[model samples]
Every structure is written in structure tokens, then in C-alpha cells.
Target chain A: MPVSTLTDPTLKDAHYLVDTGFEHGEMLTIVGKCEVDYDGRASSHLAPGERLVILKPDGTLLVHRNKQRKPVNWQPPGSTHSARLDDNRLIVESVRSSPHEELEITFQTVVQVSRLEVDDVSDLELEGSEEDLRQRILADPDILETGFNAMATERETSAGPIDIYGQDADGTPIAVELKRRRVGPDAVSQLNRYVEALERNRPSKSVRGILVAPSVTERAKQLLTSEGLEFVSLTPEQEDISQPIGFSEDADK
Target chain B: MPVSTLTDPTLKDAHYLVDTGFEHGEMLTIVGKCEVDYDGRASSHLAPGERLVILKPDGTLLVHRNKQRKPVNWQPPGSTHSARLDDNRLIVESVRSSPHEELEITFQTVVQVSRLEVDDVSDLELEGSEEDLRQRILADPDILETGFNAMATERETSAGPIDIYGQDADGTPIAVELKRRRVGPDAVSQLNRYVEALERNRPSKSVRGILVAPSVTERAKQLLTSEGLEFVSLTPEQEDISQPIGFSEDADK
Candidate 1:
């Protein structure tokens, strides 16, 4: 294209393929375009052509970007939190990539301000009342909260007993008791101890006990079934135990 | 243990397990102590009976923290950065869990007050003089200044060419035209075009051509090798070249 053609009004709103002249990542500046969404980087799908246009706050535009846009060379590394101007929060859903490994995130600041945020696809679909939220937390396949502290025969001291607890959708309580390999007479005894301790304290009627493991010992399952306690097995399918949760509170500020 | 025996004089400057009467991960106030260096967290490893001590910047002690460490029971959602002391700067080495994978860090204002700066780890271990530094950049494994730009060819409107144009260690000119994949007859022809275009405009013997890719066609490699041009073959080790050779200065900043 001619130099004059590059300055044409038609291409003003379009994204110009600016070469950052760096190595390893792709960096592009939309002449007059603001990103409406984030498709993985490096795909030309950010929108076709080069153009510039002023956008009103209330105006909406349809942008078709190549899915393969990547970072241009010399660009710093970072993650996108959100793609929309109005949307300020980015939620990254917990994904299990390896067996027997828990995912963790570390940052220097507990909070951040960013033009980008990641939305967890699974977390977006949660909907329901308090009862539904509670049920969802119990059956959530992604996380399992167990109550081990409740099974202590007695308070060994004020040090406190170990307790495994997961919250329900409406902030209810769900306690789970887990077995390492198999459940047997010992598990039954342990469960009895926990039930008795919990009964003494009577934390909440909504607080239910669940026994989870890869394979429940026949005796443990039988005990739980006989006791009428609910139980679930671990699986990869993300079960909605609650609503989409995040703590980006710019509105309040 | 009796409160009278708590003030033992034998324990000084040695690590001791403070009976933090609370759970792990919870913040505790330093209440009482004899003399020791406790970073505020209490470990469970006390030798039957040991006292906890905390040091302070001023001559006076802060407080003794014991029986107050609470275990981290809840992870706040969307909190990305960790807590830093008043005198420390936040440096993000890498992002742990993210939607779009990239490293992130920020330098806070606190470090500026403390006169702390980012460490140059890459340059520390190497024993290099001024000349060596320049020569090292020219050599492989040390990425000095490299960039990419669109160059025009006679047959093509424009082709993406990687440029390794910079000053050598000795302040001499340094420039190279590199092809990411295979070098074809057109590539050789293309390099000649770039060289001529660059030489005609900017005369420098430091400008050269480099063809980089996996194994090239035998004939193509022969031709490029014979012309005294550089060939960066894709060895098994080089197959995974996603990492940059040198750390960017801004990466840790």
C-alpha cells in the first residue's frame, strides 16, 4: 500500500500490523479499534484491515479477529484478565492439568488493575437459590472439602482439631470425611467420633457429612449408606456447587 | 508448661518453636519472648520446651508471637499479588496460574525509598570485560539487540524478515538477515535483495545473511553454506526454542 493509502480514512478504524521489531511475541495496536474481546494472542482475527474510528461509550461494533494472533517479538509476558472496557474483572477457572497436583497462583499484590481479565467458562453458568447454591457446593467435582478435625475423640488441648469444610452456594456448610485407601472398621469408628463431636457442638443442621474417595471401601460405603449420610466420588467434570464468585469491587469504591 | 518457667535464659539467638496457640497462616501479635529470631510464624518443631523471641529494627523488641498462627483456611478469590514489607519492592518472576500464560511483576514505591534495586543475575556469574560483553552479544546464546521488520522483495510486495542488527561488542556495526524456516532459492535471492537495499542505503561490512530452520534441503544448505552465509539448523535441542536467551531488563522490573 502507498504511504498515502495507509492514512486513508477507510483504514483508520482498522488495526495496523505494526511491527514491534522485537523477537518472540506479537504486538499490534488497533488504529482506532478497541478490543471487545480476547481471542488467544497471535491470531490475525483481532479484526481485518487497518482503520481508525472514534467510538462513543454507548456504541457497539462487531469485530472479527483471527484466532491465531500471537505476541510480537520483544513484548513483555503477561496474561489477559478482560477484553471489554466495561468488564473490569477477569476470572481464571481452576483447571486440573496433572494428576494428584493442586493448582496455585502467586502474585505480589493481592489486588490488581488491568485492562484484561480472564473469565472462567465453568464459573459463568452458576445460577440458583440458597438451597441450590448449597447443593452445588456439595456436588462440585472440582473441590472437595473434608472435615477431619471433627473426628477427634476429644480436644487434645486448645490447639484445635483439624476440620475439613467446604461452603455451599448460599454459604451453607458441607463437611466431608475422606479415607486414604480403603474404608473399614477404622473409618466407621472415625466417622462415629466425628458425628458425635459435631452433634455435641451442633454447628448447623445444614452442615452435612460427605465421604469422598477414589473408591469407597465396601464397609465404609455400607456405613455411610446405613447412616443415610450423602457421599460422592471424585471426577473431572466440574460440578456447580455454587455461583460464580470473584472479588473485584470497583463499584463499591 | 508453667508460666514461671517460660522465661528461660538458655535460649538466645537460636530458633525455637513458639507454641502459637492459634491455627497456621493466621497473623499473630508478638506477645512475650526471651531472645530469638522469629519471623513471626511459629513452626510446630519445639524441642519439648522452647521459648519464642522476635527481633526488632530498634533496640526494643516488638512482641512475642506464640499460640496465634492460624492455618490458611480460605483463599480470597481473584487476589493476585502477595504482601510485601514496607521496605521491599514487589518483583514478579512469573505468573503461577493464569488464563493467558505470561510472566508479570511490578516495582512498588516502597523499594525506591529503601534504595533497593533489581538484581542483574544474568550478568553476575559471567566474567566478561567490556570487549567480552560486546563479543558475547554477537555470539549465540546471548541475545543482545534483535528485531524484526517487513522488508520488500522484487518478487513479493513484502516479506517478514528477522533482523539481528545492532552494535558489536567493539562498537562495530552488526546486522544479519535471518529466515525462520527453510531457505529456498527465493530466500537466497531475497537475502541478496535485502543486502543490496540495506548496503545501498547504509554501507557496513557487518551486515550479513543467516538462514535458520530445521534441516534445510541438501542443495539449499550447500548453496547458502558455500556463499559464506550463516546456517542455523534446527537441532533436536533447538527444536524447543520458545525461551529467550537473555532476560529482558523490564521482565523483573
Candidate 2:
């Protein structure tokens, strides 16, 4: 069966099904009124409420309330999960080590429980990331600045990897940092570190740092100015200006 | 009915149930073989695969595969959702404005669809936060420093809100920044901004800046030293040493 569901089952039945689901590596969903306690990097306690709890095969546990996108409490993947009937209540616990977090859910009433067989193996292809921004600049170096000669990307330095490393028309070394969205002083600091590393590698040479992003915060701008860095306004998405406004040769087709 | 489920429903039936689910403001879960497309701050496309799709009444959508804690793709709360039948496929669309993101799922085969009635209205009470750390310091100021007297918390500064504002034994004003976890240079920069702001506000008086966290990164330590700031090793959680090791009063009870 692709899915096995029980509505308003006895605690013993629910525990049996949950244990079977765990052993068979199935995704289980339990809707019930439960109080949750979490102890880890942080500790939290949720009062008794009816919520949806998902236990994934890979040891991901999510306790979601009705109102928000984020789980009220969650144990990340690689946690060990167990379910048992304690007294008359069904207790579910998920535990993970190395930082050590534990999530415990005690159910007052189980409204529904389901075990699902899921098979998924597809990768998401994404665009308009920092990588895409780098690609755009590499494809048209003039877009960054006229006479900007591209040299290397993800060039490693003592500090970290430079997003785009190159030289200008004057042959002065330049280190470029790319951000897909509006950034703050941290990005500026990152670029500064890379520039400092480059200068240290070649003490006689001066390296110019440029930050490429859609926009920058006021503090970031101030820091850039203090550090003698440059900012270029650009987005990761390719500009729509490539389409001609008027007549097209393929209009008849 | 608390939950209405359909297994291997026809495309038309799935569309009808989905439309009904939307109209009734119920949580809907759809498991199917589908391809997904997303466009917004970023864009993505997922090839056909079996996955679980969740739609919350508050207008949140989540696309989950079998693995990973995070949803493969999600539209946060407040995105409008709609389902329609196109040719022989069922297409569900979620869209939100102000940054304008859209997620589209085209299901080639609907395995199961469930509409659940959920009622949850409980807030999570959390501990081991920066606020908890602040409380711990306020309760026993000496943990921060000898003769340290806490004055205010969330004190307003031009840069932002200072976590804790206090005075040292010398009566010199101190601005303490709190972090629940280990931090990097960004935390140092934030503390620096607050200290600078405080100095500007009272030019003649010397102000001290201190960062309190479990630990600091190497670069952050260097930056703190350069700025002449101080770091104290502390965690948000109350120490377990409160219990006497050999003789516990609770042992008799």
C-alpha cells in the first residue's frame, strides 16, 4: 500500500504502527493534541495543542502548528526516533548527538496517523544566484567595467576565495566580491579580507576591491568608502533589455 | 470529517478536492509525481519526481522530498494558492507579491490527497536564547564581571539595540552584547558600532564594550582585540552545577 492511515486509533495501535513505520523506513504523519519539549542548543516547551507532526524516514521530525510556515519544533535529519505508550499517552521522542538535541512529544489524543511510501530523486536546477552573477560578468566583462580583463574565479587566497579575480586596463590587480541581493557591512568586510590577503601575497602590488550586488546598505557604503573600495549595482538575473521593442523578423511565424 | 483523503484520484477529482480544500481554509497534503517551477528572488525548476506538497490555510506552501529537514521549495506564509486542471494534468500555483514570488507544481499523477482540519493556538516558550543569557546576567551580574551592575537591557543606540547596558565596578558605563551561540566577526562589528555610538553620545566619558557568548571565532577574536573590546565565555543555559553532587536533598524525597 502506498499509504496506510488510521483515524482516532487506540494509543497501543498508534504506537505499534509508528514502530512499524520506523522500522520500514516510511514517512509518518500524526495529527494529535500534544505537548512538545525540546532540549538542545536551545530548549523550548510547547503547551498542549492539536498539531501535525511529520517523522521522515531520514530521521527528520517536524512539529507544525496550523498558522506558520516554520515548524514550531523540529529535530533535524540524522536523529533517532522512537514511539512508546506510556500510561495512556503515546510518547514520541527524537534524539540527535554531537551538540545533542532531544525532542519529546506526548500525545493526549491521536486524531489520525498515517504511514507513507515516498520515492523522490530529483535535483533542483536553480538560477539567479551568486554563481549566475559571476557567469554574467564573465560572459561580458565590460558589464562590470570597460577594459576589465577577467583572470580567475573562486581564486583562493589566504583569507578565503575571491568571487572574481582579475586586472584592469592599467594592469592593477582587482578582487571582486559578488552578492545576489542587497548586502551589509559583512560583505564589505569579506571583500576587505580578500584584498588584504592579495596585497600581503604581493607586498609591492596594490589590489583594488569591488563589490557587485543589486544594492548595499548605508553602513556598507560607508565602510567601502573608508576602505577605498568600489560598489557596482547589478542583479543576478539577466536584464530583460535583450528583447527588441519594435518589429521582429519572426513576427509572421 | 477531520480529514478527507483520496487515493489515486483522477485529475478532475483531485482538482475538485483541492479547490474545495482552498475554499474551506483547511490544510491540504498532496503526494504525487510532479514537476515544480519557482520564480522570485531566485528561480528554479525541478524535474518530475514523487514528492509531498503541503498547503497551509495561512497561505504557506511547502514541497518536501523524502530527505532533508528543509523543504526543497517553499513559499512562505501569505502566498495565495490556486489549483486548476490543464489538459490532463493538475497544476497548483502559489503566488505572493512585494518581491513577487511564484511556485507552480504540475502533477502528472496524483497518488493521494488529504484535507485536514487543524486547530492549534499555543505559543512556544523558549529558553537558552540571548534574552535568557541577559536574564542570567541580570540575575547575577558578577557572572559577567566582579562588581558589574546591570543597568538596562535592549538599550537604544544609534547603531541598534544594545543587548545589555551596565556599569563596571569603577562606575564606567559598559555596553554588553550577548550571543547564545559561537559568533564570528559580524558580532564584533555590531559591538563596535554600539561602542562607537555610545562614545559619540558621551564624548568625555570612556565606554567599554564586551561580547558574551559561548565562544568566538579566531577572526572575531582578532577583530575584538584590535578594537580593544572584551569577550567572556558564557552559554545561555543555566549551568548544571546548581545541583550538589554527593548529597542531594531530593534523594530522601
Candidate 3:
């Protein structure tokens, strides 16, 4: 059976199914009224409420409430899962080492329990990231500046890796930082660090810093000005890319 | 009905259930083979694979593959959802404005569709947050330093709000930045901004900056030393707080 479900099962029966599911490495979901406790990097307690609990074979566990996309609590992949019954309650616990986190869910009533055999082997292809922005600038350096000469990418400095190292038309050294979306003062600080590192390395020469992003916050603009840096408005994805033909917008029907 | 389930549904049947589920404001889960496309702040395309799709009542959507804690793709709350049949396939689309993002899922075969009525009103009680750390310091200022006086919290500055604004025993103006966990160079820069703002406001007095967290990265420590700032190691939750009595460690049995 690809999916096995038990509705309103007795506590003993639910425990048996959960034990078997853990042993057989099947994905399991339990809908019930439960209270949760978490301890590790942080600590939390959830009062009794009905929730959907999902346990994946790869040791991922999620507790979902009705309203939000993010799970109320979760154990990342590679945790150890166990179940037990005590004081007329069913308890499920997940624990992980190396930073050491533990999440415990105690159920008062089991509305439903399901075990599923899932088969999925697909990867997600994404665009409009920092890498895409870098490619765009590299393919057409003139887009960044009219006389910019590209030298190297991810060039290392004592502070960190400079996103792009190049020279302007005037031949002064330039350190470029890339942000895919809008930026704030943090980006300015990052660029300042790289510029300072370059100046320290070559005491007699002047270095310029430029930040490339779709936009900058007012505070970031002020910080850039105070630090003697520059900003270039650019996005990771081109604006002119058209959507796929035949993609329907009539889904409401 | 609190719950409804359909197995091996035809595309037309699935579409009908999805439409009704959306209208009734129920949480729906669909298990099927599908392809996903997202266009928004970024763009992505996922190839055909068996996945679990969850649609929450408050305009949240999640597509989960078999293995990870994070959804393969998701739409945050406040996105309008709709479904339809196209070319014998079940299509679900979610769209949101104010940045204008869209997510589309095309299902080749739907194994099951379930609508669940979840009752969750209880809020999570969490500890070990930055707020808790602030409270801790407020309760006993000496934990931060002997004779250190706390003047205000969330004190507004041109840079941002200082987590804690105070003075040292020497009566020097102090700006304290707090982090719940280990921090990197960014935290140092943030503290620097607050200190600079204070210095600009009062030109005669030298302002001091302090960072408080459980720990600091080596790079952050270097940045702190170079910028003439201070760091204090402290956790949001005290280490001596004991676990509840009778909390079982024998859960493996």
C-alpha cells in the first residue's frame, strides 16, 4: 500500500503504527491535539492545540498550524526520531547533536495517523541570484560603467573575497560588491572593509569601491556618501525577458 | 465534515474540490506528480515529480518534496489562490500584488486530495530570545558590569534603535547591541553605526559601543578590536535553569 491511514485510532494502535513507520523509514503524518516543547539553541513551549505533524524519512519533522506557510516548529534533516506512551499520552521526540537540539510533542488524542511511500527525485532550477547579476555585468562591462575594465572575479583580500576586482577608465583600482536586491547600510560597511583592506595593502595608491544592486535605502545612500563609495542600480534578471507562451492566467475559472 | 478525502481523483474532480476548498476557507493538501514555476523577486522552475502540495486558508501555499524541512517552493500568506483544468491537467495558481509574485503548479496525476479543519488558537511561549536577554540585563544590571547603569532601551538614533543604551562605571556614554546567538562581522558594523551616531550628536564626549551575544566569530572579534569596541559573552537563557522534573530521558524505549 502506498498510503496507510488510521482515523481516530486508540493510543496503543497509534503507537504501533508510529513505531513501525520509524523502523520502515516511511513518511508519517499525525493530526492531533498536542503540546510541544523545544530545547537547544533556544527554548519554546506550545500549549495544547490541534496541529498537523509531518515526519519525513530523512529525519525532518514539521509542526504546522493552519494560518502560515512556515512551520510552527521544525527539526531539520538528520535528527533521531522516537515515540513512546506515558501517563495515557503519546509522546514523539526528535533529537540532534552538534549544537544539540530537541523537540518533543505530546499528544492527548490522535485524530488520524498516516504513513506514506513517497518517490521524488527532482531538482529546482532558479535564476535572478547574485551569480546571475555577476554574469550580466561580466558579459557587458559597459553596463556597469562606460570605461570599466574587468580584471578578476572573487579576488581574495584579507577582509574577504571581493565580488569583482577591476580598474576604471582612469586606471584607479576598484572593488565592486554585488547585491541581488535592495541593500542597506550593511552593504556599505562591506564595501568599506574591502576598500580599506586594499588601501592598507598598497599604502601609496588610492582604491575605489562601488556597490551594485537594484536599489539602496536612504540610510545606505548616506553611508555610501560618507564613506566615499559609489552605487550602481542594476538587477540580477533583465527586465525584457518575456514569460513562457501559452501559460494560462484563467486559473480562476 | 471536519475532514474530507478523495483518492485517485480525475482532473475534473480534483479541480472541483480545490475550488470548493478555497471558497470554504479550509486547509487543503494534494498529493500528486507536478511541475512548479515561480516568478517574483526571483524566478524558478521545478521539473515534474511527485510532491505534496499544501494550501492554507490564509493564502499560504507550500510544495514539499520527499526529503527536506524547507518546502521546495512556497508562497507566503496573502496570495490569492485559484484552480482550474487545462489540457486534462489540474492547474493551481497563486498571485499576490505589491511586488507582484506568482506561483503555478501543474499536476499530471493527483493521488489524493484532503481538506482538514484545524483548530489552533494557542500561541507559542518562547524563551531565549533577544527580548529575554534584555529583560535579564534589566533585572540585574550588574550582570553586564559592576556599577553599570541602564538608562533606556530601544533608544532611537539616526542609524537605528539601540538594543540597550546605558553608561559604564566611568560614566562614558555606552551603546549596547545584543544578539541571541553567535554573531559575525555584521553585528560589529551595526554597533559601530550606533556609536558613530552618538558621537556625532555629542561632539565632545567619546561614545563607547559594546556587543553582547553568546559568542562571536573570529572575524567579528577582529573587527571589534580594530574598531575599539567591546564584546561580552552572555546567553539569553541562563545555563543553570534545570529541566522539568520527570521529563523522560528513556524515550527510546
Candidate 4:
């Protein structure tokens, strides 16, 4: 809730009492150029340079460069840390005892240091899953077409989880394979396996396999058609997948 | 960027130009609940409800429910798209021909729509890579210690890329392995292999292997100690790793 900027670079024996209740407790933000040395599985080092160091509330230690999506190097949570300013430098040490790993960051020149306290649960959280998407299709078959009606979701097969099990207007058993990406060869193979298994188990009717995705690959199409399967494109609406189940509060106007 | 809101429940025959000139082009922000059908990897459908669909310039389409970082279901880029308002609904379609993938987003009810345009490059860019970190270490021997000096980086052998190859203070041959996560059993095993290979090839001198990462797993530590290795911890200053290279201008002041 409160933030303080460390004007004086040197600090020692400082204590911060962030809430213990918070899972990811406090974050220490520091900007400076310094030497980086990591001692854990293997010993390594980095030359002194200008960089930003963020000590996460959870014991995860992250080092970032100006560019990239992933931290240059990181230590997962469940570690203890201590920072001390001595001999005109800031020395911060973090240790994880289970693996017996340690991190030492020496700041040759400290520009700024601040402690961040998480105040509220304003962060977004979505409880979205593959099953949620399947349930949606089972609720409405018109999305696929006027004739398509999903009989079941998560149909168990020897092959794997069949997203949808349904029948066409003509009463042919349909096995649907669902994925987020364009249909690929692997999906086609999987659908074929399920269809073959179903057909062998129930010879009275022929089972049709349909590969469903937002898109389909040329390879997938060839594979699907050659294997006697169908393709359907479904675009999911842009919505938060994290909202609680049956919670449609955002667009409730 | 000009943004617009569609208050009308029904939309028909709408056209917008989201240029491919932008790497991640235009982001179409839509909020509402509707069915999501992806006909690609496997046919998939999501029951219509409140969610966010983001169409990126790079052809990546993302559907989100409020709290998750990853899209509930998404279609990757490298596809063509066309949007039209037919009857009282909005139809947004994306297609990839190579693998033949198509994603269709049908909005049964429209609540909001916005287009995002990126127009500036004032961002911090880091040429962040394990190689970059290794280069930094190779450039500065003092980070390792006063007596250590790095001889080479990415030293090629049957064992793979040696993060750092150098000599300790006593001129003893040292092989270094670097990783971003807690050192694991695999990393230790890898280092042991490299050391064994290096020692077998060069019999007269002793070769010391050091495993370096932000932290180490208990198993990794045990493995490293049993194999006679050293560990060091390095925490890099956090910077934006998401920025493109040559764009490091944010903290350049």
C-alpha cells in the first residue's frame, strides 16, 4: 500500500513486514548496473552493467534484459533473501535450502530501490478450460449448423478424449476431435483411430470423424479427406476465459 | 489509434482495414458471449458467453476469459481473415492455407468492438539470450572472481554448447553450464557428461565443471556435489524482455 524510494543507496539491517497472508508477498524493485554471479547447479557470472533487478514476493528471483519475453535467468519461489549495504556497495543474497542453491547480486552503483506491497486481489483470474469450450457446443448445435447436434462431450475412446460425440441428421455417429490451432496431421490420425475403434466396436453403423479447430491446415485437410473425415471451422468469441463458471457478468448490460 | 464502440446489438456489412504492415497488426477487441468454433486441429466449439477475442496483426487470434494469461482457445497467425456483418450477426473469419486452417468467430450479440493500432517505438529492447548472458560473462572475468578468466563461449563438442570454457585462478581447465531455472538433475547429468568427455579427450590436466543458474534443485545439488562441481548464483537486473532488439530506449536515460 505504501511505497518508498531509497534515495540513499547504502542500506543495512532493514526489515519489511509485508502481509504473511499474501501468497506472493512483497516485491523489491532495484535499478542499477552491477556484477551478477549465480551459484547453484553451475557457477556463472555477468559483467557489471546497467540493468533492473526485481525480487518477487514469492521467492522467484528474475533477471531481465531490455528485450525478451522470458527472464534471462530465474529462480523459482521458495527461497529466502537478505540484502545488506556495506563497503559502498549493495550486496543482496538469496538462498533456497532444499536444493542448496544461492544467489549473490552485487550492485556497484545503486540508482533506486523500492519495496512493493500487494494491496488487493484486483488482478484478473480466469477459470477457462478445454471442457468449457466443449460444453458450449453441446449447449448449441446451431453454431456448427442447423443439422448438427452434439450428443455428448468428452466421449471416452481407446484413442483419447473425443471433444464431442454426436450424430448427423442422417443418424451417423460422429466423432469430433477438437484443438485450438488449425487441424494438423496428428489430429486427423487421432480422429481416424477413434472412428476405427468405434466402428469396430459397433458394426451396425458407420462412424464419421470430424476435426474441429479455428482453422485447418492443407495437410490436415488432405489427411482428413483421405481418411474420410470432415472439417468445420469455429471461431471462439473474444471473452475472458478466466471468469467463474456460469458467470456472464461482463456483457450483462 | 482511433477506437470505436458499437452500441447496436445487430451489426451487418462492416469493414475495417487492419494493416499487415504492423508485425502484430491490429487487435480487434470484442466483448460478448457467443459460440467459438475452431475447425483446424480438431473441430471445437465454445458456448456463447462473455469473453474477449483479440485478433493480432501477426495473424494470432486469441480468445480470453477475464483471468487467464493464455487464450482459452486460439488460432495462430499466418492466415487470412475477412469480417462481414450478415443478417444481424458479425462474422470474422481467419484462414491459413498451407496447413489449410480456418477460424470463424460468429458474434450472436455484439456488446463492444475496438481496434488497437501500435504507432511508436519508444521501448526498451534487449538482445536477451543465454548466449548474451554468456557473452557478458566471457567479457568480464571479474564476475566469476579475480583469478578466473573465460577462454571461450559455446565451445563445441559432442556434449553440446558449453556456456563458458575457461581456466580457474590456478589455470585449471573449467567447463561451465548455464541455465535460467533451478539447476536440475538433467543439467547436472549434462555437465558431468561434458566434463567426462573433455577429461577423456585431454588426459593430462584436471577439468572442473561448474553449473550456474539462478538456483539449483536439491537433486541437482546432490548430483553436482557427488560429481565434484561448483555453483554460483547470478541475479540479473530486470528489464523488459518483450521489447524488440535495437529498441532499448526506455531506461536509456
Per-candidate DockQ versus the true complex? Answer: 0.01, 0.64, 0.60, 0.03
Better of 2 and 3 by TM-score: 3
CAPRI classification of candidate 4: incorrect
Expressed as tens digits, the lDDT of each residue in B80-177 for candidate 3 is 99998999899999998888999999999988787788889999989989999999999999988888899999999988899999999999999999
- After superposing candidate 3 on the true structure, give the runs of residues whose Cα lies further than 4 Å from its correct spot: A241-253, B241-253
TM-score-superior candidate, 1 or 4 = 4
Q: Give the per-residue lDDT digits (tens) of candidate 3, residues A123-200.
A: 899999999999999999999999999899999987889999999999999999999999999999999989988998
Once fitted onto the true fold, the runs of candidate 1 whose alpha carbons sit more than 4 angstroms away are A1-253, B1-162, B167-174, B201-206, B234-253
The 10-residue segment of model 2 chain A with minimum total lDDT is A243-252
* Per-residue accuracy of model 1 over A64-139 as CA lDDT, tens digit each: 1111111111111122111211123211111122221111111111111101011111111212222332343345
After superposition, the stretches of candidate 2 with alpha carbons farther than 4 Å from their true spots are: A196-206, A243-253, B171-173, B199-207, B243-253
Over the true interface, candidate 4 deviates by an RMSD, in Å, of 11.7
Model 1 global lDDT (CA atoms, 0 to 1): 0.29
What TM-score do all the candidates reach, one by one? Answer: 0.18, 0.92, 0.93, 0.44
Q: Across residues B131-165, which tens digit of lDDT does each residue of candidate 1 receive?
A: 23223334543342343222322222122233444
Best by TM-score: 3
Write model 4 residue lDDT over B33-136, tens digit each, in one string: 45566765445666665555556555666655433234456666666666776666677787877667777777776554544442222232334345555665
- State how far residue B152 of model 4 sits from its true place (Å): 1.4
Q: Which tens-of-lDDT digit does each residue in A1-253 have in candidate 2?
A: 2888788899889998999999999999898899999999899999999888999999999988877889999999999999988889999999999879999999999888888888888889999999999999999999999999989998998666899999999999999999999998778878987898799889998999999999999978987987799999999999888666667868857
- Separately for all candidates shown, the number of backbone clashes (residues 3 or more apart, or on different chains) is 70, 0, 0, 85
